[model samples]
Every structure is written in C-alpha cells, then in structure tokens.
Target: MYRFLLTRQWLITLLIALLLIPTTIKLGFWQLHRHEARVARNELIAKALTATPEPFDSLSPAPGTAVPADLTWRAVTATGQYDPAHEFVVRKRTDANGTIGYFVVTPLKLSDGKGTLLVNRGWVASGDGAADYPPVPAAPAGEVTLTGRMRADETAKGSGGFIKDRAGLPDRQFNLINTEQQTKETGAPLLGGYLELTATTPAPADQPALIPEPNHSDIGPHMAYAIQWWLFTAMIPVGVWVLVRREAKDRAKQQAEPEVTPEAVPA
Candidate 1:
C-alpha cells in the first residue's frame, strides 16, 4: 500500500509540499516584521507631531549636519529669505487624492546668512510633460519666518526606500530631496535636512497646496497578511495528508476485489 508513495507523482508532490512549508513560514515572519516596524514608526510620528515646536537652529546648529533620526517629523521654526533662482521641482510627487504632481522645493537663505535650507513648500499639479514645468507660485519676498516638520535627507539609507536619487532627470527636476545634492545646485552650504512647510508668516496665496500633516493613525494590513501566510502553511500539510488518505483507501479497495482468472476454454 505504501509503495505508491515512492512513485514519481507522489514524490514530486511531497517535494513541493516540503519546499512550500518553509517558504510560507518565512514569508509570514517577514510580514510580521513589517507590521512591527510600521507600528513603531506610527508611534514615533505621533509623539513628534504632538510635541511643541522648536527652533530649527537649536535642532541643527551646524550646517551640513543631518538631523537626528529620532527628531524626524518634529515641528521646527526658521526665518529665511526665499531664493527662487535656485528653486526646483521634485518629480513624481503625489497628493492625498493620488493625483500625480510636483513638489516645489525652494532654497531658503537663512536670515543668519550661514547657509541655505531646502524647504518642500508643497505639491503642485504637473503639466503635460516633464519639460513643461508647472508654474510654481513665487515664495514670499524678504525675510520671513516659517513653521514645518523636520525631515531627514532622502538618502538611500534615510528614506526607508520611499525615495531615492535618480540621475539624468530633466533640468530643475529631481526625484529625491537630498540636501547634499541640492547644495551643489544652490552653490551654498545647506542644512542637512529639509522642512515640510506647514505655515509661513505673511502667508501668500497658497498656489502650491500645502503638504498636509502626516497621518499616524493607520497601522495598515500587514498583520492580516502575515496571518494569511501562516494559515497557508497550515493548509499545505493538511492537503498532503488528505491526498495520502485517499490514495490508501483506493489501494485497499483494489486489493479487496476478487481476482478473476480467464476460463481455460482454449485448452
């Protein structure tokens, strides 16, 4: 009865089942790790958003120094003059409605004149093509104060894979908001991190829609996906067992039937 287990078809099925068991188990754990990371990030965002706003200089006193990772999304205030000449737009940005857009990135010449800070003013709808740059609203003139959340540079290690620097993009268009990269274009020392603009003193008409406050409320469906993967692992074994039981019954029934011999009429 068990001989059939050695057949090519059953052997292949068993091999496949063996491979799937570990694969599903690993996938489940991978999703669980993702779930845990999202939860932690959400907590951090919530904490930062609730804290009191701090002076940008206090957080980053020195130019070219990246902001501490934990301080990301913390509200910060800075005074600066907008240098529109070096301003550019980040490509492939989107709004809350999933509409494709561009992020207006303007260099803010700090009032102290020490260095410039890249400010992501907000998103503006894109034009027909990459070369057709959207008409960005001019930044407020003179020295003005602004409030925004601090964000880390969009380096490969910093953005958590959300953004990365790309080469050969159109002039005045960028894929990532990297301070180091912008420093070369602006011809000025830049603060390590950029700001997600919230409010500006002497607020001009909002042409580029302001970037909304990040939502930390959703934990996402990672946990549900993880559970689903593990459930698939359990089903694999049950399926194999069911197949084996059916095979055994079929073999036993075949044996129970009486063997018939041909009549010796020809003799």
Candidate 2:
C-alpha cells in the first residue's frame, strides 16, 4: 500500500494532500491569532470607554503623536465655543433605539488659547423631507464646557468618493470625516482630531443627545472558523488511509479467488 501510494500518479495526490495539511493548519492558526487580536481590541475599547476622559492637552504637542493606549477612552473636559459655521454632517450613524441618523460634528474653539478641536456633538434624525434636517438646538456660545472622548482625525479621502459638497447648512448632505477640511474652510486653527461626546449628561431640550454604548465586533465566529479549518486538516489523512485500505481489500479478494479451466467449470 505504501509503495502504491509512492507510484507517480498516487504520489502526486499524496504530495498534494500532505502539502494541503500543513497549509490548512497554518490557515487555522492564522485565524486563531486574528481571533485573539479581536478579543484584545474589544477589551481595550471597553476599558477606555469606562475610564474617565483625560485632559486633551496631556496627549501631545503635535497631530500625529501617539497617545498612550490607556488614555484612549477616558472622559475629557474642554472649555470651548462651538463654531456652527464650520460644522459638517457625518453619514451612517444609528442610535441605541436603532434609528438611522447623521452625526453633527462642529468645531469647539478651546479656551486654553490652543487651537480648536472638532466635537462630535450628537446624532440627528433625517426629518420628514429629504431637504429637511431635524432641528438642531443652538450650541451654548462663549466659553461652554463640553465633555467627551478624544479620537484621531479622519484622513482625507481619495478621488471618486461618496462625499459631495452642498451650498447650505441643515439641508446639506455629505460624509464628513475629520474636521481638517471644515476648519480650513473656516480659517480656524483646529486641533488634529475630534472628540466623540458621550450622553452621560442631558443637553438643552432641543439639542440631539450623544449615544454612549460601547461598540463591539464579534470574535467568537472567527475561532469557530479556525476550528473548522483544523478539522479539515485532520480529516485528510484519515481519508487517505480509508482509500488505501479499500483498494488493498479489493486486491486481496481477487487473489484469493480460485481459477478453474472452462471444461471443469459448471454452468
């Protein structure tokens, strides 16, 4: 059976099977690693959300500087004035009640004499008509204290993108990322990134409130997928063994049969 498996035709098949086993195992391991990474990421996000927001000034002197991992989800308080003229709407946000809406992000000019930081104020529902934006209450002007979590600025998008410009506010439609472009439009020296405000406290009656739930991505499914790949790897050798044994049994049965001359044979 071993020699038969080594024959040119069978050997090719065996080589393929052997090669596939390791490859499958490697793929399984890769998935397992990804599963662990997702778990870690989820944990980090959870930890950050629960902790108090740290001071925005404590992060760094420049835009691209890395903030320590532990500081990511902490609650931060900043005193600033909201610049509604520089505000932009971010597309595709949903609320805790599963209502579809857009995020209203406006620049908050910090009172510390440092430049402005973009604030993701809250979500607003699309009103009755496509041209209608749900009424957003006027932001408190002149040295307002806002609390939220810090987020990195969004990178500028490449050409052929989904964001398109409009002539006016409240009725405008666009997928705004970081406030860099909006700040440039307003000629304001804005902070590098934006802050996602949590709705821990109530805003003025007419203002849209922040959604505070922590977002989670699933890791369990990936682990199950990895196990499936490993099982396939284990099945390959068993399949080969069964095929070889069946072939051997057939050969043995042929050899054990007695041969008779045509004259001696009964019809």
Candidate 3:
C-alpha cells in the first residue's frame, strides 16, 4: 500500500515538501532577525533619548560626513541664526495626528561661523493649491540656541529608506532633508546631520509645532510572523503523512472487498 509513495505524483509531492521545509525555515529565521534588529533599535533609541544633551557639532565633526547610526536620536544643541531665505519644505510628511503635510527645513547659520546646520522645524498642512506654497510661520529672528534630537541626513541609503529623488518640484520644495543637497542649494558649508527642533531660546510668537520623539516602545509583528512561518514549516510533513495514510487506507479497502464468481453448474 505504501508503494504508492514511489509513484510519479507522490514523488513530486515529497520533493516539493522537502524543498519547502528548508525554505520556510529560512524565511522564519529572516523574520526572527528582523525582530531582533527592531528590539535593538528600540533599546538604542531609549538610551539615546535619556542621555544628556551634547553640542550638535560634537556629534559629527567633519562637514558632510554621515552621522553614526548609534548617535541617531541623540539629544544635541546648537546656536545659530535662521536663514529663512534658503528654507525649503519637504513634501509628503505627516504630523503626529497623521495629517498629511510638508516639513519645514530651514538652514541654521552657526553662530561660530563654522558651518550651517539644517533644522526640521515641523509640519504644516498643504495649501489650497499644490503649487501654492503653504504659509509656514517665520523662523525666529536673530541668533538663538536650540536643542533637538540628532538625525541622519535623508538620502536613499539613509534612515529615510530608498526614496526616489525627483526633479521639477514646486519652488522651495524638496524630497528629503539631505545635507549634501542643501549645501549646494544654500551655497554654504553644512554639518552632517540635521536637527528635529524641540526647543529654542526666545521662542517665536508664531512658530511651526515641534516634532515629538518617536515611539520606541513598539516592537511590531515580526516575532509573530516568524512563529507563523515556522508553524507552517512543521505542518508540511504532517500534511504529507496524512495524505499517505489516506491513500494507504483506500488501497487496503479495495483489496479486502470480496469478489463474486459466476455459478459454473447453472447450464
């Protein structure tokens, strides 16, 4: 009865099952890796947020060099004059309330005259027309000291992910808060990382809302997904066993049936 396992169809099924087990196991491990990475990131963010604020320039000394991954979300401060003339808005950003808007990125001229730093002031709702610029509150005038979380520049390879860089956007509109791009636009030397403005000295009467700290408490569904994939991997062999048993039983039932013989003496 078990000989049916050697049939072409069953052989193919078994081969497929063999292939899927390892594949599914690998997939499960992939999800597990993602889960581990997320947990580590949360821990890093939590630690950085709690640490003492440092000078923004101290975090990255070289101009235009990318911020170190471990320093992301680290508290930092800088004293600078807001250059509103070169300020630009990043499209497709959202507020804490999940409202679609643009992020106002203004270049801050360092008071030391060393290099400028980009500051993401906050989000503003879209205007009546897509081409029409949204009314962003003016940056506080004069020199000011501000504290914020340090963030890596938004590039295709940066924390922002693989965002496509498009051209021909509206006036003063941008895709990402990249120091390299902004350095060229402002015609000024720029520091590596930008700041997500949290507070400023002599706060303006009307300023864009401050961005909130990112939630690091959530680890997401990666672990659950990993368990599910592993469970699916385990079920494959059990499923094949059930099929083999059913086939064997059917064969046995067919063989055990009595066969009737014609009556030989009726003629």
Candidate 4:
C-alpha cells in the first residue's frame, strides 16, 4: 500500500510536504516573536514618553559615541547654538498619515562650546527639485534650548544600512538618521544621540512641523499569521494522505479484476 509513495511524483510530494512543515512552523514562531517585541516596546514607550524631560548629559555624557540601548525614548533637553553650516536634510520621513517628506537635522553646539548635538527640527514636504533644496526653517542662531525624546544612534543597533546622499538633492542631504555618520560631517565632538525636537526656548519664527507620534498600541496580526502558517503546515500531511489513499484504491481495483484472454481461433 505504501509502495506507491516511492514513485517519483509521490516522493517529490512527500519531500515538499516534509520541507514545508518545519519552514511554516519556524515562520509562525518568528511572527510570535515580533508580536512579543512590539508589546515590550510599547510598554517602554508608554513609560518613557510621560516622564519629565531630564538634562541630556545626565542620561549620557557629552562628546559620547552612542546612547545606551535602554535609555532610548526618554524625554531629554539640551541647550546649544545652531550649526547651520553643518545641517543636512534626512529624506523619506513620513507622517502618521503616510505623507512623504524630509527631516532637517541640525547640530546644536553645546553651550560649553566643546561639542554638538543633532536636533531633528521636524518634517517638511519634499519639493519638485526645480530648486536646490527643500524649504525648511533655519535653525536659530546664538544660544538656544531644545526638548524632545531620546533616540539611540542608528549605528548602535543592527537594524539596517543607511542610504547615503541621494542624487539631485541640495548640497547637504543624507538618507540616514545615524548620528555617528553625521558627526563626521559636523567637525565637532558629538553626544552620541540626537534629539527629536519637540519644543524650543523663545520659539523661533520658523520650525519644522512636528513628526507624528509613534503607534504603540498595535500588536499587529503576527499571532494570527503564525497560527495560520501552522494550520497550513498541519494540513500538508492530510493532503498527501488523500492522494496516496486514492492511488492505492485504484491499484486495488485493478488487481481485483480478472484478466481476460482472447479465445483461441484457427490460425
């Protein structure tokens, strides 16, 4: 009964089914992990966002290379002068509604005058590139203060690579939020992390519009996706069994019938 499974097509089917079971199971587990991570991040964000703004240096010292992983998303404040010459636009930022735009990242020279901090002013709509650059408000000159959430340097995490300066944009344009990379451009020591500018002291005449608040409530469909993949894995063997059983039945019928021979005739 099982001999048919050794045939070319049946064996191929068995092999594919065997391969898919573990693959689907592993994918299902991956989705579950994604869901769990989202939950943990949300819990962290809920606490971090509400906390009072603290001095930037208190979280991490000045002229540092990277922010601690656990300290990200915490509210922090810094005071410095804008280094407009070193400013660059971070492209492809989007709003909560999914509008394509760019962020103007400017370095804030610490009042101590020894180092600088990158302040992401905010999002601005992209232009037709008929001109040299996107229209963004200039960072104020002289001493200024900034307040916003803490975000770890992009290089600190192994998320993805940054797309370097794009073509046809203004002179100073970048595709990364990586402070480490931008620090090299600033020609000054950096504090390892950048501020997502929320407010400024003595509000400037111009400022980038606020970026959309992050969505923390969505656990996404990972759990359901995982279950669906697992369910499909479970059905693979059932399908193979159906085909094998039908083939066996056909063979049985052929064996049950008697073979007929032509009657001998005068030759």
User: Candidate 2, 201: how far from true, in Å?
Assistant: 7.0
Residue 54 miss distance in model 4 (angstroms): 1.5
Q: Can you write out model 2's per-residue Cα lDDT over 1-267, one digit (the tens) per residue?
A: 345666788888788899999999999999999899889878888776777656666563354343455555556777767777767666656777878777888777777877777778888887676556555666666667777777665543432464454345444445565455665566665666667776423345556668665665666688998999999999999998898898788878877998878999887
lDDT of 4 by residue, 43-125 (tens): 88878888988977678545546687677888899888898888888777786668878888888877865567778889988
Stretches > 4 Å off in candidate 3 = 157-162, 260-267
lDDT of each: 0.87, 0.70, 0.90, 0.79
Tens digits of lDDT, candidate 3, 1-267: 599999999999999999999999999999999999999999999999999999888886477788999999999999989999999998888899989789999988888877788999998999998787999999989999999999988886653575677889999998888988877876788889899999989777988878889989999999999999999999999999999999999999999997756874476
The weakest ten consecutive residues by lDDT in model 1 span 57-66
Residues 109-136 of candidate 1: C-alpha lDDT, one tens digit per residue = 8887666788999999988787787888
Collision pairs in model 2 = 52-74, 52-75, 53-74, 53-75, 53-76, 116-191
> Candidate 4, 189: how far from true, in Å?
0.6
Clashes of each: 0, 6, 0, 0
To one decimal, what is the Cα RMSD in angstroms of model 3 from the true structure? 2.2
lDDT of 2 at 217: 60
Task: Please identify which of the two predictions, 3 or 4, would achieve the higher TM-score against the true structure.
Answer: 3
Task: Report lDDT (Cα) of residue 158, candidate 3.
Answer: 52
Stretches of candidate 4 above 4 Å error?
A: 61-64, 112-114, 128-131, 155-170, 258-267
- Candidate 1, lDDT over the whole model: 0.87
Instruction: Score candidate 4 by TM-score against the native.
Output: 0.84
